[model samples]
Target: MKKTMFAVLAGMLAMGAAQAQTLSTNAADTAPHFYMGTGIGVVKDSVSGDRDRTWKIFGGYEFDQNWGLEAGYSHLGKTGFYVPGTTDYTAAHIKSSSVYAAAKYKYALSERTSVYGKLGLSHGEYRYSSSAPGWNFKESNNGVYAAVGVDAKLTERVSLYAEYERNGKRAWNGPENRIFGAGVKFGF
Candidate 1:
């Protein structure tokens, strides 16, 4: 009986030591790091039912477990409008892009997952050009930008994220561009 009890206690101690080693080796650090990612999404104009492809490339520094800052540029895509009564021919095209920065706040949901929100200011330039000669227009707007997203860690220095972001209006009372996208981030 004494030998049996000693064996059982020894086994339990060994198992506990192994478990602790596993967790320590796999745990993510809260140290600051830099990361970058690119994503593609659709920019939809609600009234026009126009779905256009938009893409962005962004990079940032994560300060700790819950805060970061990032800046990015987006190619907001182009939308071609037909003449008022005709769908067979194109009349004008509007293209836009933006540059912005934001502060990110993250909340960890688990060892490998988190949700984050960002609020920022954006400046966008929109250009309208007509098929007809000498009919071109340009405008720009500065407004509020916001986003919410979930991130899942894939490895020690990699993650995948899906987000819904609003790029705000192109002008006062102009159409707002909303985007839904997913992408991967690499940390360094």
Candidate 2:
């Protein structure tokens, strides 16, 4: 009876080990190693009467499930700035591109849905052009970037996310910007 019991216990242990291996494999498969995404949103200058249609394209590498490095280019489009108390106006085409190394903390709401917050240091160039004489500007800046978002998996390799992000202030007295947008990501 003792030998029989030992054999049964060993078999159960073997099965458990195999099951654990399978679970680990599944988790790794779902974890994103590399991803690329694009989003469209509106960007507004908080200190100026400038608002524009914005779009961004980004790609990143996940070191683990909760940490990643991301780089992106953002086109803030044309922003029309009206001189206060005057009918004179100027339009500036703005573009911001950044590279951020971010830490992401996430809480799983379900098997396929999660909420995450990202905090990072962003280094980028801010460029703007205006039709007004001598109004063109280009500068490089580093600042803090943060975002809170929710992600839902649509497939094993594709997911959709909606996020509100503060892209931080640019150097040289550039206006701060924010974006609320949705994006789709493909994982590899």
Candidate 3:
């Protein structure tokens, strides 16, 4: 977690320093400006395919052609983990949530459409303890995500898009969350 934040901050500082020398309000610097957006979303846990909704928020600076930084939180719900033997172990109604920080690079396909790739650290959350009956596990773990999606500029300062995200489980989670969501971002 600390390393991820450090990277983000360092990257942002580098970008800022670089831009300071070339940025201009005129056509010479007609490059893209920084913008931020946030919205709500839903996450579907692999276990039982249950869905937990959450407030999704992300913000970063968009520059030149297509480059930016974003981070957000995703609230997830309980998922069932069914073990085959040992009295058919069941990982209770465990509540889960995720927090992620990513850096994205976009490729513009048109004036309003673009595709992006993002990589970063994923933090997962759960409520559990050894003494708890029918449930014993780590409360959190670091994960990874690979997503592909399209973004459309809704207005000069706003945009909308949907992304399909997949994550891998570090331990046991049937599978990570398979999520699809649409959100709108308004630039400031």
Residue pairs of candidate 3 with colliding backbone atoms? none
What TM-score, to 2 decimals, does candidate 1 have? 0.77
lDDT (tens digit, per residue) of candidate 1 on 1-188: 33543453344334434443444334344889899999876677543766667889999999988999988888888766554554557577777888889999998665666779999988898887876655388888877888887776666677767777887575422235677766778999
lDDT string, candidate 3, 1-188, tens digits: 33543453344334434543553333312366666666554665666665565556667666655676777766555555554444746545556667777778888554445667877778877764333354566566877866666666544466666666654343356324655655777766
User: Predictions ranked by TM-score, top down?
Assistant: 1, 2, 3
User: Cα deviation of 165 in candidate 2 (Å)?
Assistant: 0.9
Name the lDDT value of residue 62 in candidate 3.
64
What TM-score against the true fold does each predicted structure earn? 0.77, 0.68, 0.66
C-alpha root-mean-square deviation, each candidate: 13.1, 14.3, 11.0
Instruction: Judge candidate 3 against the unseen true structure and give its global Cα lDDT, from 0 to 1.
Output: 0.59
Candidate 2 Cα outliers beyond 4 Å, as residue runs: 1-25, 29-32, 47-51, 82-99, 170-175
lDDT of each: 0.73, 0.63, 0.59
lDDT of 2 by residue, 1-188 (tens): 33543453344334434444333234764465888898776656654646555677888877766667776766655433433343467555555655566666766555556668888877767676776666677878777888887766656567767677777565343435566666788888
- Candidate with more favorable, higher TM-score: 2 or 3: 2
Tell me model 2's lDDT, rounded to 2 decimals.
0.63
Question: What TM-score does prediction 2 earn?
Answer: 0.68
Model 1 CA lDDT for position 18: 45
Best by TM-score: 1
